[model samples]
Target: MRRFVCDCGSPVYFENDFCINCRSALGYDPLRADLITLADWGGGVFRDLQGNAFRYCSNGEDFGVCNWLRPADSPSQFCKACQFNRTIPDQTRAENKERWLVLERGKKRLFYTLAQLNLPLLSGWADPQRGLLLDFIEDARTSDKYPETFVSTGYLGGVITINAVEADDVARATVQDELGESYRTVLGHLRHESGHYYWSLMNPEPMLLAEFRQVFGDERKNYQAALDAHYQNGPALRWRERFISAYASSHPSEDWAECWGHYLHIYDALDTACSHRLLDRSPESMSMSERLRAWSKVSLMLNELNRSVGRGDAYPFVINEVVAEKLELIDLAMDRLRTLH
Candidate 1:
């Protein structure tokens, strides 16, 4: 993520709601893609330093789950980001409020990276037919009130459904341990699900599709059967030599999505590293080969840093020559996908 600064010249963060130095209220402007310091002018009117008038999102005022800003003159009270939500967890339960906050922060970070990559973002409410939406829901397993309901985090059509428990650290760690996964987080879930959403748009030209098949395998296999088999027996040995994760080995389609998610992870993390002067090269300036080389080195150092702090490796997967070729395919496909915008 990019570092942000408050209008008061105090260093702020993407998730911040107040500026420490100026003691001014802060809201993230999705349009400007920055945190803005606001001054309360009384009577519910808030103005930024440039005199841009705004209002906190209704969700923010009601439940403190949102930090986005809406224009004071906007016809709808919801900010650009909040307008994309089709369902939020029931906020009557206090725990739900905190879980929703965690979910939104991860979603915002996902949206930020997509925006940075110049991908198109539209709400289901806006298009109804093609636009995207999110649903953060709870099931019987997570809440007693929701008997007979079981929700899994996944994407279908254009909607992404995230189980509310994924936002809870204990719940998430339990699943992570059970699955024997090396890395998992709210942002990782969002990025992975988004890969499914984008795959629905990957109607590449005939030549490109052939190339895709050569690298990532044909995606025509039965997805459900593959997933079922994967869950029953686990990934094949030496899976890491070819796939980004054990789950990626389940199906050709999954392999693509897993690689796509890693592409975003590597790109965004590398960009942040460059911004912080931790890397000598910028992602935009490096060739695909150069970028991968830098990423391999940086990721190793990152893992070591975690080890030094007595934590697990920050990134636990390896990127071999074969995986690098697949990633390059992703880069090409992303370039093609952006043209649709």
Candidate 2:
């Protein structure tokens, strides 16, 4: 979430397509990890001032669902981020198009953070066995067209399926209330589900699995049974003392995903803080304990600012000593995972 500036010295945002100040067209270059102000070279091709040739993602040209750019020499019509999509809502339907647009915005933001982390990313098309992909689908609850379908926002076999209704704020909020959730958003769901994708990539060894069980719980436990119990009986009275969220208490695997999601949330927030000059160092330079200590001061000020504006706390969750230890394990595991290839 770093602040961006247009070439004309005007403030720009990551999602901006046209700069309001200089009337320049903006395009994000996935290779350079930058938003460039484009100059029309000729006949639908564009060039950054540095002479890097590019083209807008096809979705951007056709449906305006993306703002990313791909190298002109590349054979792909989609940008690196869009290449991950295995399916999308029907664009012919106006409502579905609008929902897909909102969903793309969230997906792009998620991709931006993922790129910033320097994690290994590949489209499932490129590596069918283990690469990541996304699918935006709807079910009976969200639409009348499919009365028997039920698609949850989840990751399985390298595919992330996000229920299309999650794009609609009212629908999402209604579900949040129905489920008694304190916080939920399209970005949060993607972040949490992506943890499952990467965890599959990790495929823990015996020692690692043993360590994860000690920190979270027995991941070997029945997932469906645990979820059934969670919804039926609810979390323990002191759940917050251990889990980052009530849902995290449902199963050990979920605990891992929740911790994984928060690990990302913390990184992005600190990255933003550094961008704003409120923090003096990059998150990569800090230890896990240092990050927690820094986040405490950072989150406290953030909560106070939210209170000042009469909004709820910007961050509703806290990391206790136990959670901190779990995060450290996640950090270590990710470091090892990243080095494998």
Candidate 3:
């Protein structure tokens, strides 16, 4: 993320709701992708630097779950980001409000990277055919009120459904133990699910598809059967030599998505490292080999830092030769996508 400052010249963060120096209210403007300093102009009115009036989103005012700004000229009261939501968790439940806040923070971070990459951002409400949406839902497992429902966090068509329990620390930790997973987080879920969404748009040419197959295996295999076999029999014995994670070994398409998610992770982390002067090279300048080398070193340090804090590795997966080949395919895909701009 880029550095942000308040009107008082105090450094602020993307998630800041109030400037510490001047005590002015702050709201993130999704259109400009910046945290704007707002001046209160009396009852329900706030003005930006240009004297353009705005209002805190209803979600912000009502639930303290959002810090997004709604333009005064906008007919809809929802902010640019909130307008994309198809369904939010039941806010009447106090626990649901906190979970939804966690969900929104992850969603906003995801949007930050997407916008930085200059990728298209459209809402399902805007274009039913291709736009994206989110649904944060709870199931019977989480709440007695929703007895008949069982919602699994996954992506389908253009909508991403995140199980509300994933936002709860204890609940998520329980699942992590149950699944025997090494690493998992709200941001990881968002990034991985987004890979599925983008795959829908990845109409690679015949030659590119051939390359994809060579690197990630044949995506035409029976996905459900592969997944079932993986769950029942466990990952292939030599998975460490080929796949980034045990789950990535389940299916070819899954391998692609896993690699794609890792690609984003590496790119974004590298950009931040560059911004903070931790790296000598920017992501745009680094070759695939350079990025892999840098990431390997950085990832080791990240794991060590987590270990020091008595937490699991922040990024537990390993990138082997085979995974690197797949990642190169993703780099090619990203380059091809750039041409579409």
Candidate 4:
């Protein structure tokens, strides 16, 4: 993500609702992809320095879960990011408020990166067949109301359903340990599920399907059986030689999603590098091979920097030769999605 600066010259974060230094209000303008220090014009109306007008999305006004802005003259109450939500966690409870905020923060970051890539993002309400939607739901683990409810974080058809407990650090860490995962987070889940959503959007043509099989294997295999086998018997002994993560070895689709997620990781990291003058060109301007090579060097530096501070690696996995091939297919798939009719 890009570092934002308030008009008062104070550096502001992406999720800030108010500028600490200047005491000005802060909001993100999706049209310009700029986070602005707002000039309040009264009655919920505000404008940026360029005179572009906006107001907080209703989700923000009602629940304080979002910091995104909608066009001042638009009839819609929700911002472009919030429009994709088919269901949000119940907010009657105070704890759900904080959990929803965590979910919204992850959603906004996911939307920002997808928008940055210029991907086609039709809401499920807009295009019933191929559009995307999100649902944040809770299970019995954290809620007394749903004694039998269990919702796994995943993508099916066009909707991505995330288990609400994932927002709580203790709960997430417990599950992460139980599952023996090296890494897990709300943002990672979003990126990974979105990869599945986009793949459906691809609805790959024969030639593309043929190409995908050549790289990621056949996705037509029995998904449930594969997952059952995966959970029952861990990844192959040499899974790391080909897959980005152990869970990815579960199936071809999972592998694709894992590679796709790492592609975004590399894209965002390299973009940040260019913004800071660490690199001469943006990730968009580099070839896939160039990006892989640059990212290898950069990711090493990132991990070393984290170790210097007594923290774990920010990016824990390596991009092996086989994983590099899967990422190449992901770049190609994104190029195809960009040209959809």
| Most TM-score-accurate candidate | 4
Give a tens-digit lDDT track for model 1, residues 238-330. 898888899999988888888888988998889889988899777878778888999998999999999999998889999999889989998
Clashes of 2: 0
TM-score of 3: 0.94
Give candidate 3 regions above 4 Å deviation.
339-341
Q: lDDT of each model, Cα atoms only?
A: 0.87, 0.88, 0.85, 0.91
Predicted structure 3: clash tally: 0
Residue-level lDDT for 277 in candidate 1: 89
| 2 or 3, greater by lDDT | 2
Candidate numbers, best lDDT first, in rank order: 4, 2, 1, 3
Ranking by TM-score: 4, 2, 1, 3
lDDT of 4 by residue, 1-341 (tens): 78789999988988987898889989988888888889999989998888988899999989998889999998889999999999888888889999999999999988889999889998999899889999998889878898756679999989999988999999999998999988899999999999999998888889989988988889999999999999999886799898999999999999999988889889989988888788888998999999999999999999999999999988999798999988998998888988984
- Best by lDDT, which number? 4
Clashing pairs in 4: none
Tens-digit lDDT track of model 3 for 201-299: 667889998998888889999988998999899887888899998888899888887888888888888887787777888877888878999999988
Q: Could you tally the backbone clashes for each prediction? A: 0, 0, 0, 0
Evaluated at residue 185, the lDDT of candidate 3 is: 85
Better of 1 and 2 by TM-score: 2
